[model samples]
Target: MDLIKTEKSIEDTNKTNNQIESIFTSFMENTLFKDKFVLQASYTPETISHREEQIAQIASILAPVLRGERTSNLFVYGKTGTGKTLSVQRVRNELLKRDINSNNLIIEYINCKLKQVSDTEYRIFAELIKKLGGNVPATGLPTGQVYNKFLELIDNEKKLIVIIFDEIDHAVNKITDNFLYNLTRLNTELSKSQISIVGISNNLTFLDEIDPRVRSSLGEEEVVFPPYNALQLQDILNERASRAFMPDVLEEGVISKCSAYAAREHGDARRALDLLRIAGEVAERNGLKKVTLKDIDFANEKIEKDKILEIVTTEPRQFQLVLLSIIDIVEKNERLKDNLSSSIFTGEVYNNYQRLCEKTKNDPLTQRRVSDILSEFDMMGMINSSVISKGRQGRTRQIKLVIPKALVPKVKKILIDAIHLS
Candidate 1:
């Protein structure tokens, strides 16, 4: 008993000595961005904290009184990361706060960003319904049936249901538009749950592609949230600092610098917050007491590296090959035009690809896949393609790299380095 007591005392003392909560607390308090809306935990946040006007605008449009007339719908369009998702989420919360009856007011947020094909809409529809405790099946159901089931749940919610289709552009391809049309039109025939759709998209041209009938249904209201300016971003950072940080661990310049960078990227508050948090991490990794200007710079580089690689990884294999080939072509030619005919460009890509793999001693991918990738690259905005006749061969689509003719050298260098290093 005496030996055990001594051991326990020693162990407790050692554990106490090893613990560094007080020191770590300083780091934790300084950089944690706790804005629920901005962090987008449930949805996106009102990080800028002044979208109250927009939030109220969205809420007023879908006000509960509109339930009987099939919900009046809405569409929000803007560039990427302009707080569309976050704004819609803020409105959802506000709507729910106003004496929402679980059976009546049903708010569902579906991120179509991850769903691509037409059929996937059915899945998203089912998931949204399931989240609301609707009787949604596990799959194998017909699209019509699943859609009907989704409507049935909406009907049951019967008061005011606000559905947010976030990143709607990603899934706006030909096959998946059925769900969009139906959701807007569901109440035209029946009066169960009035649903007002709040579609959030980055593409300004998304509305042009929707069928006239769908557009008519979806044109209930439109509100565009502008990106934050640097001054606005700095204010946002200050607001967050009080709640998220502990002491003077965060420097004043941190907010300004992050704001400047984020402002340059269209004044995205989320980006600013991300930079600040990442800067703190860089500091922590380097065993620094607090994040500083140097750490922020390092974080910026890291963000750029990760962003570029992520952009590349998401590209189709053919596009990746095309990009890789362009890097090699620029290296060899020393001078390439901003736009070359697709026929000539494809030749360059194919030839350079062969040479690059040989020099790097890497196995070359087949040309068929390369062709497919190039097509996708064009589609995904990596390069441009157009049909041009090749004499007796008839019209064939030509391809060209859209990158600045001068910047091609740097882009090529980075891409090649990424390939061999990774």
Candidate 2:
């Protein structure tokens, strides 16, 4: 009986291998992409459509670099996928191309969202030093020494150094606004070279959180990029699709549906491109010649799941605790077959949240603050909240988790691990 079972298992393994080979063979034969990179978010096209005004504005602001003069520190504000970074990059490229002297201008870009790069003031200075052809120990050195090394590297040359801090708010949040104040004050210390800052953030009100001195220096010139409209997104999709896919690979209405989906997401062109690319991938995996509406649907669901997971993972400690409290209520109600599962009250969530905070040894935020987080959750589509009048008892919000029942367990696990809940 053992030998017979071994032979049966070998046969099953061979069958599975053959099935995998078939799928690979199909993928190789009917690949739908002609130039997949065109659909990627990182692709910088020869011409950026629908952002001419923003580009011109950035170019004008930074044009002083051509005369070997220090340009005003520029603050760029925009929502995600609104072409802020791209426009700034376009201007940077154009400036480099037009400037006759390269040594007089040095431009460095640091993405503050990147790990191991902008977590603290030391890392930020270390990154800048390395970018300027200087090296320092990754750790164990005093931050002042690293700052001196950076200043020395830039000051040795008679050039204007422009450091672009993308997602600058993240760095400020991690390492206070004192760093910004020091950077701005460095101009008074430097004898040869002047330094300018280009701060970029997705938050419109990021400046409001900064110290007034830092804000005045860092936001000398401000540019805001508005979200693209549905038509603008459609234009972008049509242009990218022409190059990203093979002839007749995308079925009719797929582009429109993808554009509409991204439009509802505040006109996120990156999301639209991702939707189209993922839809094509889904079609190819299914051995289809052309992407269909069903493929778009599948892609949307996949992106939604990924977006929610990312949001939950990166949220603040309080957010995770609040979300966990909701998850617990929902799970307990489901297990007990209770009818109140759909109408979890705010007071109940607050009570559970307090318990979670106590267990984690965290000082809980005020009830008003927790209520604000729930409102934010509602805005983010993680929950549905409705205000119910209790007549003489006052008013309370009726809360329900909208995070697809299937995803609840994974979100719960992330919250549990993040908060170290046993």
Candidate 3:
């Protein structure tokens, strides 16, 4: 019996290997993508469409840098996928090209959304120093020491330094806005060199939230980028689609469907491009020659699931604990197979949350705080919450998980692993 079982296992392994090999062979033989990177976010076209005015404005603002003059600190605000980063990068590249003969101007860019590089003040300074050809120990040095090192490196010569901080608000959230004040004040301490800043944020009201002191020191010239409309999105999609896929690979209306979906997302061109790219992948996987409307729908569902899982992975411990408690309640109720809705009350979730906090040896937040987290989750579409009032008894929220039944197991596993729950 053992010999037969071992033989069967070997057969199954061989079958799996053959299946994988066949999939790879199919990918190589009949792929749809001509150049998939054309649909990627990083690919900068020679001429950016629908952003000419914004690009020209940014260029005019920074044009003084070409003549070794300190330009006004610029603040750029826009929603995601509004071509803010691409326009700024294009202008920066132009400045570099125009000033190639002189080493008097230096420009650097940092993405503050990256956790490892910008979660703390020290790491931000360290990353900047490293970019300027200086190295510091990753840790063990005081933040002030790291700041001094950066100042010394940049002030060693008579040059103008322009540092662009992308997603600057995210950095401020992790650290304080005092760093901005310190950075903007650097010019006063330097005798030969001057420093300028270009802050970019997806938050429309980011500047309003910062310290008034930092705001005054920044002295920023503001630029706002409006979201694209559906027609505009169609134009953008048409250009990228022509380059991203082989001719005749996309079924009719696929681009239109993608544009509509993205327009509903506030004209996010990046999301539209992602949809097109992923739909192509779905088609290729299904061994279909053309990307159809059905493929786009399937890709959308996949992206939604993946986006939720990503949120689960990145949320704070307390947020995860709260979500886990809700998931546990819903799952237990699911097993009972009651005819009623799976929705539970805020009180029940709080109770389960308290147990989880105890099990993990973490302090439990107040019911009010947990409810606030639940409201945030509702905004993120992870759950549906409603207020129900019972006269003098006051009111409570009716909560239900919005995560698809198919994703519950994966969500539970991630929560368990992240919280170290037994």
Candidate 4:
């Protein structure tokens, strides 16, 4: 009887294991996504929407390369997710397709925002060398040696090379503008090959801080991408949805809500797609057949929380302290009065920040430095700051937290723990 009972237990375990595997297989087979990657920002669509003028302009500038002529270096500026990178890449793809057999053109694309790739002058040149079919060590080599090797490699090829530097400002902020000068000046040393640069930046004033000579050389033809409106964003989402999701998986008004939310926040198509994707994931997790408006709300909440946590945890110590100061001010004001507003000015924030620094035994930055950090925080969407004039009292920025109110306590706790304050 004991032997029979043990064998029956083994059989039952096997049956349960098989049932779990079958359930997982069924879940995978019935997912709403036909091709989920089509919704990702990195996945460039075969056709771009609402960027015809910019595409034509970029194509015209790069068209000269097909005829073996050196085109002018181009600069493109726009807010994040305005399709600058996509448009430029699309044009490059077309150029490659046209020159499939000619072997007369070489396109090197590097995003400076990526670490260890385009973070410094050495890394940028090293990447360029490797992309040109030459190998260079990641580090420990003299900068001049890297430049010489890159120059030699390019001079050996009689092809037209176009280098696109996406997020050029990140590297420029970390290092000097000498890399730009070096790239612009490479043409003078090359005998057979010609190099043209396409620089893409989201910062409109990025050129103002760079060396004048570098700016003049790199901005021969500049293109600006305007932010997309609600209608444009909706169209983009609809096109992507048609490819990414199974039919009728998304309920009506889901796309519209995503588009409207992103359109209100500078018309970011990337954010809209992220919202839709996350909402679909939420629906799938809840075993819902269709993504609904409530799922979008949940997705927005999740995205905001994740973004806040990421920024707070990864940002510099000083930035974390500044954010903490804002949270403290808002919480204190709310506790003190039922109707008091929590909005504060730069001067007030700096004062509170200095106090926090002193209490923590850290050296405080000057008010000017704090102001600059505030501007960066504003750009990151952690805070909203508007310049307001006080007539004869001069101008100052009115600052308010953009972080979700529900997430404030969590942010406060994280900041407190990070600073090691009791």
* RMSD list, candidates in order: 8.1, 3.9, 3.1, 5.3
TM-score of every candidate? 0.71, 0.85, 0.89, 0.82
lDDT of 2: 0.90
Ten contiguous residues with the weakest lDDT in model 3: 1-10
If both were scored by TM-score, which would come out higher, candidate 3 or candidate 4? 3
Where is model 1 more than 4 Å wrong at Cα?
1-48, 65-71, 100-103, 116-119, 156-159, 174-176, 314-316, 327-346, 354-422
Residue-by-residue lDDT tens digits, candidate 3, 1-422: 45655778999989999999999999998899999999988899877899999988889988898889998898998999999999999999999998988979999999999998777899999999999999999899998899888889989899999999999989999887778888888899998898899999999888889999888766468888999998889899999989989999999999999999999999898999999999999999989999999999988889899999999999999999999999999988988995397788899999999998998998999999999999999999999999998678778999989998899899999999999943
How much is the lDDT of residue 287 in candidate 3? Answer: 90
Residue 346 of model 3: what lDDT?
Answer: 93
Residue 254 C-alpha lDDT in model 4: 94
Best by TM-score: 3
Q: Where does model 2 exceed 4 Å of error?
A: 1-5, 99-102, 310-325, 331-341, 347-380, 386-397, 409-422
RMSD of 1: 8.1
| lDDT tens per residue, model 1, 125-229 | 677767777766667888778777766765653466677777777767724567677767666755654556778888787888888888877766788878888
Write the number of the candidate with greater lDDT, choosing between 1 and 4: 4
User: Per-residue lDDT tens digits of candidate 2, residues 230-296?
Assistant: 8899899999999999999889988899999999999898899999999999899889999999999
Residue 108 error for model 1, in Å? 1.4
